[model samples]
Target: MARAAGLSRTTVSYVLNGDFRRIPEHTRQRVLAAADSLGYKPSAAARLLRGARSRLVLMVSPGLESARDTIGGDIVTRLGQLLAEADLHLVWQLGLPSVGRAATDLAPAVVLVAPTEEEAAFADLRRRFAVPVLPAFPGLGGFLAASARAQVDHLAGLGHQRLAFVRPAAPAFDLTAEFRQQAVERRASELGLPAPVILRVDDSRESAVAVLRSLRTRTDPVTSPVTAVCAYNDQVAFALLAAADDLGLAVPAEMSVIGVDGDPLGEWTTPTLTSVRSDTAAFVSDLTSQVVALARGETTTVEARLPEQARVVERSSTVGPAR
Candidate 1:
């Protein structure tokens, strides 16, 4: 580069490092142009050798297929853009055990865990890599809980006093489903309503039909028949919708339903689903800012600063209880 630009090695180095304030503008431009023509790029390994942090950010998550289907791609794109603006690179790795090798190999400036994973699970990674390991977004549990509360609030506002909580029977969703169900139960109690009946159903229409039939024919005095339902997610809600159609139950009349995760498919469903939408853009922006700050060695509180409530997208699937 120095030979091509007709400059000394020290002068070329100064220009590349942006320390050319004292050098002539023409000389700096010459070095930059030469480097550009040569297709030169800084080496992360070289930077580390020079006592500078590598410009790589490692993101780790479980190997869940649903991760990409639910806001994962959006997060990667938006967060990668933000990191690029700051001259950092983002590498997303699926699986927890693999992150140990990634941390050693990549030597990322910071490590980010998927929100679905517990931060405590990665505590050893932080100590081993001596890098910041944090949740990609803070307060994800709280955000989910708030979403569940929003469903209850929406149904309660529509005069659906008795409600049911429909959770997916999948073991993968057990932890998250528990969190959402607890929120629904708490919110209902707060609104002076009876606790929602909890029903676990699989993706199969048969599972949903059996649960619905049981709810409709309940003679137990402890809990009245529920007129509305708060589904774990759009998929669960779809199962219920299909079951309702199969049983000839009129939606939003015989039974109302609300869901979380505001999936786009909700729009195409019969009697389009009402759902609580997570602000993915805001979440990605906030998470990017946090990662950048941490990479810069800035101290940030662990507490989440995001909005406590999620927005409800109203659709045709919900309404007041029938008289």
Candidate 2:
């Protein structure tokens, strides 16, 4: 094990003893692997006989039971993998009732999820947890603006001038949506657009389609009805496509559309969607790194960063302006 890790026996022994001082992430990974291979387990038998459990890190959230987003699931999967790879066990627990402290006693290091924007989850996690906190999202404007800019640039290059965006009314004032709107507007103006259009809809796809239908029927004062549109996600983007069809409009010929999220459904749609592809690999990788770091009894600070940028994925849903 020591030979594989390129570490002296003493060094490997130190890591096996849970003394992680002065070790880089790679080195730590190597030593952990080495110890596992050599079966140098942390003896609970010894610790129990000694009257103490080996302290470990834990992931503290408002309520693991209430986090129902697929995105969140993906994050947890990656995090679990990273922790396992590091010979660390991840424990997820909820702390409610108290807004600033966990209900249960925990290990010294904790990973509290503080999303970038103000969220009920963030409030519960940050103020309630007794350990280090890691932010899930980026610091508002910059990330959102960048996401919008990248999308807008791609659509414009595809001959989209009269473009639109579809979003739902956010009760919490979504920083992501706000950022995109601002960036879309600013960039459109600099590019000589009269005004960038945004359509608000209820959360449902049906409502979003109805809004798109209303938008399609309007007289576009910009010399052209919007020929291209952005949907909040691939589902809505596909709904917009259906909305155009219901309105007797031909896609790309009469209108074109794009969406965010490279959801698997996007590819199966009649016309595959052009979307902002999420680098799920990178997302998972970073999520794993962060969570495992926390699970290993290491401190996760506010600045523990991960990539959140969305990339464009081109497909048949978009086409050049009518020939």
Candidate 3:
């Protein structure tokens, strides 16, 4: 096969084993075409018998089948690059049901990057394969709780006494968002800020607009307005900002908004979103290191603690509330 493709045996092996990140794109294509023409397939059992490490990592994306690339592309890309350095390969499995003990037949570790609700189905995968099942979100083992804490602290420090947390009604099992909301509530009480309101808005621009309308409008002077909002993610934050604009409200002046996930599109918004962003480099490194350790029957303190840092990225979307 190596001779047929005019490439070295190691190069062919890398391509066949899905560890071809270091291989040039054109060369990879040639190797792939050769293998396709020869009807060749790499057998996991054969590699294992040869004393080769499985080197495969399966990432399960539940309820994000259609938007995994859009939502998790950055994290996945960085994770692949980091793993490839150690000759490990990462592959994504869509839908929760597709993940089970059978998945460990292809990899030694599984990364679950979905909500907590989908976790139960994979409990058997952990018990059956003895493989580590890691969560990549902020809450539940990642940096989400910290991200929410940062968002709340930033807004409260700016003198926004009354705050709100906004999330979509769908993806009811999005424990990441749920954790962020809880963090905000806890932080508010700790800071002596007014109790924050939680709003489950429909996941649409129009729904957000309507929600903003009701919140920002109150004829009663005694009603303390919600001066700051922390959205579940950048998508919801963007909607709220747009809705605020439609109502002719002066952001940061009359109201402030912040969100999580640090989506690149947030920077392009009219007022540039202020967000609580994941420490991508640290996150990828920690997750990769922990999974690699788990694969080797080694344990790390990271398993019992959150491994990523969350910090606020200030932008035009926030300021001290009006007196």
Candidate 4:
């Protein structure tokens, strides 16, 4: 840039850094034009080392496998736009294994992590970077609990006294599964309903079929046969729907099903699925504000005021059980 602008390196540096009080206006314009022509962009690492704020925000998540089909992708897209408007770049680190390396390389102003991530990882990021490292949103546990309760409430409202909780068999989803299952159990107990029959299911349709059959045939004098299911996610619900179809069970009449995640695929199923959709706009907006504030070094410890409940998207899969 200095050579192209026909100026000293120091002169170019001052102009690029916006220290224009001493330098003439023409010199600053020349340097900027030269930089633009050369496509020269400032390095975030360089800015950070110089004790200046880097225009980088690092976002780390468990994985991107389901991002394209899930709300996770939408949240990331909106978050990037918001950050860009604030002159900050959102850099994603897909998995935890690479977070330390990515943060070191990017020199981000702040780090945001998925709520399901371990606390040790959060601490490591803060200790290594000396920057703010926080969950993408606060009250994640509360949100999960609320969503789970909403599922139970919807089924119970339809006179479903016997409910089953379908959890993912994958170990990767253990944290969220535990939270939602506990919430379902607690809500059922509070409503004077029988405890939810809990079961773990994989992605296989056969697994879902076997699980559903067991729920139907299991002899329990204390509680009635499972009439409704609260699945951990839409995928599980879809599996169960297929199982029900194979068994020739009339959905919402013989067995009602509700799921979390509000997956769009639900609409195309044999019976459209009822789901709890997490309204993430407010949470994303709040997160953007915190990222901007932290990047500007305004303050730390911004309280996350997330939504208390997730909205239920009612569909054909849930209804009053047959008399």
lDDT of each: 0.80, 0.63, 0.73, 0.81
Q: Sort by TM-score, best first.
A: 4, 1, 3, 2
lDDT of model 4, residue 273: 95
- 1-323, model 4: which lDDT tens digit per residue? 78899999989877665454557877777988899999999875565567666678888776443333365677789999999876678987777776667766777878887753355655655676667787875676787798899999999998999999999787777777898999999999999998889999987888999888888788998778889999988888999999999878788788999998899888899899999987888888888888888877676565555566888999999998788
Clash counts per candidate, in order, are 0, 4, 2, 0
TM-score of each: 0.82, 0.70, 0.74, 0.83
Give the better candidate number (1 or 2) by TM-score. 1
| Candidate 3 weakest ten by summed lDDT | 63-72
Q: Which of candidates 1 and 4 reaches a greater lDDT?
A: 4
TM-score of 4: 0.83
Candidate with maximal lDDT: 4
Q: Write model 1 residue lDDT over 16-123, tens digit each, in one string.
A: 654434578788778878999999997667767766656789987663434323544666788899888765789888777666678678988888775434545556
Q: Which candidate, 1 or 3, has the higher TM-score?
A: 1
Give the total clashing residue pairs for model 3. Answer: 2
Maximum-TM-score candidate: 4
lDDT of 3 by residue, 141-223 (tens): 34667788889889988878888899877774355567778888898999987778788777577898887877787344654
Kindly state the number of residue pairs that clash in model 1.
0
lDDT for 248 (candidate 3)? 87
Q: List the residue pairs that clash in candidate 3.
A: 138-143, 138-144
lDDT of 1 at 61: 66
TM-score (C-alpha) between model 1 and the true structure: 0.82
